[model samples]
Target: MFKGDLTVAAAYLTPAGGAVVTSVSPVGLADRAANEVSFTTSLGFPKKLERILHNPRVSLAYHTREHGFATHSHYVLAQGRAAVDLQPSAQRLAELMDASELFLGRTKRGGVWDWLLREYHQNRVFVDVHPDRIAVWPDLSASGPATVTGAPWPRHPAEQEPPKNGTTPRVPVAKLARQIAALPHRLLAYQGADGHPVILPVTVTGHDETGLRLAASSELLPPGGRRAGFLAHGFQPQCVGVSMRTVTGWLTVEDGRALYAPHTSTGMTAPPNRLVTTVANGLLAKQGLRRAQRNGTTARLHDLAARHRAQGSERQPTAFEDAPAQSTRPQR
Candidate 1:
């Protein structure tokens, strides 16, 4: 039940191999025939796109139902490999207009609308995801077991080895804990056996030298440990003035609880006004584009566009084994 206006939390990994969770706006089932889902971002925000390019495994979690899919108590965690379409030709964008309207409301004409959304629309890059494992919980509370569907769940009896020396909290536990507590939305991201990321909502119950103590369903947290990511944020519509805290570290899940040892911490808080936001986006996009130019990423994106133009299709969806159509969807 992804709708354009519904915001969902998404996760991806950094090149160094740490999970980072963030929010994506207006995601939806972009291709009904293919059963494909996608989210969009601009070239201005190239970092996440770059990360996706490096590693395709990602996840989208739907914990809310307002203005979204069928009203149900189910919470869905969709994990899959993702493909990014760097900004393409104007014709491609034209083809996307109908779907855009379906999720994002109709477009307007004239200069005012143009001025407000110029940066937003100019270099729209779409990230299309083909889910491999979809875990549906009985309720948003994650109180019961999940009804797993799609491709088989890959198991990692012995998760990939941790770093040689092991990881510890880079940011002071007190500071990180304090920051995390201030934000209402807290999510944890960890690498699965298949390298796809698993993300689940968690509560920051407490913290110590080991890491930030987390409270989550044991079923969602693998008992053995692995390096993981933690994100805590708060936002209004469009996430204009969002304030978020992120940390990458070690994750230990056992005894129905979890612990995170943060190896690094970073965060940002932006202004809320659309005018101010657009201005800021323009400036940042300019700088990011310049960096892309210097790194030859600009040409790389153009090459991808050319390839896409030649092929002109998305990643084909796979069947969900024996599950019936209705069962494949999140159930109440």
Candidate 2:
């Protein structure tokens, strides 16, 4: 839990209702005090904040081994409810300084820098999720059964009927397959019975009319068919130069094999220039804030002040304290 710098995080949504989105998320572990895990997002990113406010049920998948994050840990999945703080107190932002700088280099606050990044750094939201279920696989392959700690696992919902008028991958198979091959890293997400999303590592075997052929062990997959999100992403050292492609659609698992029918696809590519990246981030944040204003998300706030109020009297756990020590499954 402590070692990771970033995770591929999921927030649930639907098509008619919307769609679930997953992204590169960095949860500041050093700032997590008193037995809770959390990640911070810019108030500028209105869509993500709105979704979390709508459905607090979310998940974080910690599998990064490169760029110096989560290197010692096996693939871990944490599913739980998220409590959001849209209007943060100065005290909360003050508490986040150390961990924030540790993952993302030091904050450069000055004349032009302060004015440029005002909304991005100052106007932000924090989300805390206390895991109801934490599952671990031996490694990123996710080839065998996971050692889990939480409430009893739900029965496989195999008999439940699939959604009517299921969606298909709108993008051409050949085009996306090439892109997927270039970006080898992959993650798959689907909502659990409790509505919290579950994401695990997967491999792309090939592609056809059924969408991308996803390969992973049967134990890791949710049985039968359902709507799901797929992410193919890669990053260079020090989190420089990155690319990602996200797909949302139907996921069908049978005979120990799975197929992902992508309904929609979106992506971004960035070069290895830090200055350019920083500039782009500021611009995007400003635009996102405006979008939120237009959509009225800025007006609705779900305040989570319980933790901040108790900060003075509570004792925060050290990095290794929260995760359970026992492993129910054999490690390689």
Candidate 3:
């Protein structure tokens, strides 16, 4: 089921009763001799690694286009335990890195591969996940339904409790507004027509008191008015800090854009961890520099930071009822 897919969305529990979901590209599946469906990922994502270490229970969702047709997309969600494998032999490490390079369409002779290999040797480790339950949607058409194996499918935590007072709870307008503006990227999680969850990265084009305006490619857009989850995360190197927020609501298509009106929201911030925070920020900076070089431009993190600040300051309050606010320091 994982064939031809470059990346997967991994979700794991946080110490604070919330969850974090992030995308990671798998090097390849583990040996078939193992009784579980396992895949490997690098440890460059310190926060995800730390969370997985603290809570091994995790879920992974992969979406793939069937035969290059967006409308024929299929998805798989696997619930598993993510174990850190720190002591792989040098040969195994080399093999894993080579596989990753191939998956990313990079050749051994490429300068990009050389730089990536150096980074992997310096900061990467492997995470191997053992699936306990698996669900597959072979087609996303309206007639399709998810097929489950290994264990009974579990309902999402958000759906376990009914909304209070016949309406979804609202979050503090300013807090949600700031979070919507500060993060550089947003992740959208929604159920496909086949009734399986699909997660994809999207761009937040605009925001207001009512909701956020999302700009997604036609291929990534879900059915109109579908319930979906939106997540944003940001890190500050100078402060050695990180923040994450998730908002869920109904998404409607209008004027060729998706409008999401948040009903429930949760956010959390981590105390500064100097070493990990610095490493994470440096990795992100290097990636930004590579993208800038490829595009023949000189953009930097500070420039993006300034733009986020300007956007956050201009945010207006929403009309929703007040809710307890989470503290989020401005990114530097």
Candidate 4:
């Protein structure tokens, strides 16, 4: 290969179990002598070459592209090779000015040229491949008119199985959404001052339709400001023959830390108030469905349903006149 060409680079099986094609020369290429027709690398090769050249049977393929057709110009197959010459001690200290210049030219913007040169000096090696046979294959598809073969190039050890979908494991979607909605309360529930609910941040461990399961607490903040207190809220819905309608959890505060109580249980509950019944009745009325007359009790349920539905749609919740007062803990 000549200078100023990127495609003519050499590929080698590295000792550390990988295939590498580097423009960086591990061995000096031009020390062939005054009139010698052959050349070798500066050092022998990486120790990996020991395993690779053990049998001394190898094939090297080269591709030349011209006018949309690739022409194979120089393909050399070699065998029965041995490390014949060690790099001369005198030449070991000797540096190749051309390789140094090539190294400098190879760098891009912002490269530390001197540092790379030093590294190259420490790692470069030279190898001499003894030729047993040589072949030049012009076309790979034709499988015709080719010379030199022992076996295909040894498989590189670095080839790994393509990962399934390029990832080790993946998560499902629907369950993830439910976990997100329930995360805040489940993570932060701890006992607040005077039994008030302190809300904490939550990191979910798992999730499903029922609730988000927790692996860790959400009480990560330091005490101060509006966050000093906690509030608890619960919601439960009831419907005939729908035994699964229930959702409840607690929020709490303790020791300047807030956390959510775990969601340990659930079940359908009767409507919370007369308004709830009124709202349910309104829903039925809007559908033009009236319950059979039963001591006018169904009418009362309808009225209650209407009331609850109206309250539910309020822009801001109305404080219950008999709502439980939040307890305040004494400051330490």
Candidate 5:
């Protein structure tokens, strides 16, 4: 299903136990025998990289839509351990770029490939992921179990070694509440019947010391009560910093509202140094200039660069905390 599509979302755990989900482009997929997937990204070390380095466990989701009289889609979720290869062979990088160009229908010699090659050579890393479990929803409307494969979904590594005694550390619900209130956006990820992960940008309707009240579409809520992943992240461009919080728990729909009982929660942040931020900002400016030239726009590049600088300088920091875990008793 991922053959031609480049868009995919990767979810990984931060040191603080938060899950960071972000959009990524799959440069290439290894053969089933190899049991690995590869993607390429900018050279600068981002927050996601930190999470992956600290914890190799990750989840990757991909889906494709068919539009027409009757809309339909197919989705897959691959839970795996990702290894970041900082020094991949140049030949491998070239092959991946070639595959990306072919999938994008770009000319082999020049065009986007040329620019991508230059960028790849200058700064880029390849992340190879090995799947441990895969779940698929072939049809969205079908009320059936997802086709599951591979090993059972492992609990967060931290959970494996619960404190010496049986008692676990109590999550600070009040702290989390305050953090959620400050977040500008929330993302909810659920598995659709069609075997794909659906990520929705939602608004936090209300929150208390216990849990959060989120506004979500009933369609995204699976029937018979199921769990979903929620993530909230804030970007502070001025300081080139990012903070993210994650929750995994059961979701229920009642009276047109969704109640979330967060089972596990975690949070983390990435604050780059001033030198790194300046370099990144410069890269952003150069990219904008290239885009403007390609689009035949005049002097828009500088404007775009200025806008980025202003947004970075002014955006506020967002804080996040973990939500309290809900009971495992089956929902009625």
Candidate 6:
């Protein structure tokens, strides 16, 4: 849709009760992630449009090359509402003018036509279409199609396949752990308690979603401090059968070697209890832990610790409390 150019041939039932032939240029392509596209056009006969479109009803159509020897005409009709927008920042207008020459391959000289051309940019209007009806058909003839049908298009064979046998292999956890441990100082940056920047030694730990379960040590986490450390781990790229979000696996680390085994019986539980409980309930179902018994533990611990944190001990409160605080704080 972003690659082709369409010419605006005419407008009907407009304010002046006449037709205008002008062109509308495509401005931008859709951001695939967000699903949106934008464009700009000129109403060549402004007086005629303003007069006829007291209740505007307009249709737009374009022809584009499709598969070999076939072409398609796309049509959309918008009625009742059309808007005219004339606000553009100086930077925006300059960029638009510059882009116009690059795209259209022409520039205007002195005269009323030049003035009109510049006004087309400076006063360029917007027609927002909220179409009540839309129809698209693959047409081979420029004369347009006489009938439309809703039928499944033909599909090529060899596009179908059966599921493969056996599970996919992952990048060994040992390699991942080594990468984290030997992670270069070039990428390390941190800030101190006073908001001044500092660099700290990196401590690597293998974690699967719920939390990082590094050995309880004074070096990794100081004895008097909270047992908290950052963890970074993701699904091995070659693990074809597993998705990072849904995979149930163990991150085995021993003697500086690590391995990720999918469809295993191991469960990762991060501390302070509640987060670990939730992750265990969701992903660790295959393990023998009973749901009712686990829920009892999580609720009891939460009730016991909720009031304790209110007394202002510990570096941070539980995750459930942290979420509400983040939401209530207004953005700057």
Q: Which model scores highest in lDDT?
A: 1
Candidate 1: which pairs clash?
A: 4-26, 169-262, 170-262
lDDT of 1 at 188: 84
Error of 4 at 83 (Å): 2.1
How close is every model to the real structure, measured as TM-score? 0.81, 0.84, 0.50, 0.28, 0.49, 0.30
- Compose the digit string of candidate 4's lDDT tens values, residues 246-302: 122322233534332222232233254534543443343333222223345334434
Q: Is candidate 2 or candidate 3 better by lDDT?
A: 2
- Indicate which candidate wins on TM-score: 2
Q: By TM-score, how accurate is candidate 5?
A: 0.49
lDDT of 5 by residue, 228-329 (tens): 667776554222354567766555555667666666678765554544543454465457445645764423323443453354321111100111111211
Instruction: Tell me the tens digit of each residue's lDDT in model 1 across 33-90.
Output: 5555688777666677767776677788876554434455677777777778775578
Global fold similarity of model 1 (TM-score): 0.81
Residue 82 lDDT in candidate 4: 26
Q: Judged by lDDT relative to the true structure, which candidate is superior, 5 or 6?
A: 5
How many pairs of residues collide in each model? Answer: 3, 4, 0, 35, 8, 10
Model 5 misses residue 94 by how many Å?
A: 0.9
Indicate whether candidate 1 or candidate 6 has the larger TM-score.
Answer: 1
- Please give, for residues 1-332, the per-residue lDDT of candidate 2 as tens digits: 54464545555555333336566555344233444567778766666666766566677777676655443557777776666777779887776655566555666778987777777777777777666677778877776777776654565544235556655666787787887687757888776665667677888888887688888767768777777788888776545577888877778887878888877788888787766776777778878888877876677543323433343222223322445643222111
Ranking by lDDT: 1, 2, 3, 5, 6, 4
Q: Give the better candidate number (1 or 6) by lDDT.
A: 1
TM-score of 4: 0.28
Against the correct fold, how does model 3 do in TM-score? Answer: 0.50
Compose the digit string of candidate 3's lDDT tens values, residues 1-332. 44344445666664543344554555344433343334554433445555566556666665533111123255566665555554467886667656655444343345654564454443345666565556655543212456666555544323222233332326554567776576554677664332334455567776766677777655456444555677776544322355667676656765567777777787766556754543454465467445644654323322433453354321111201111111212111
Q: Which segments of candidate 3 are over 4 A away from where they belong?
A: 36-44, 66-73, 107-116, 140-143, 155-208, 212-332
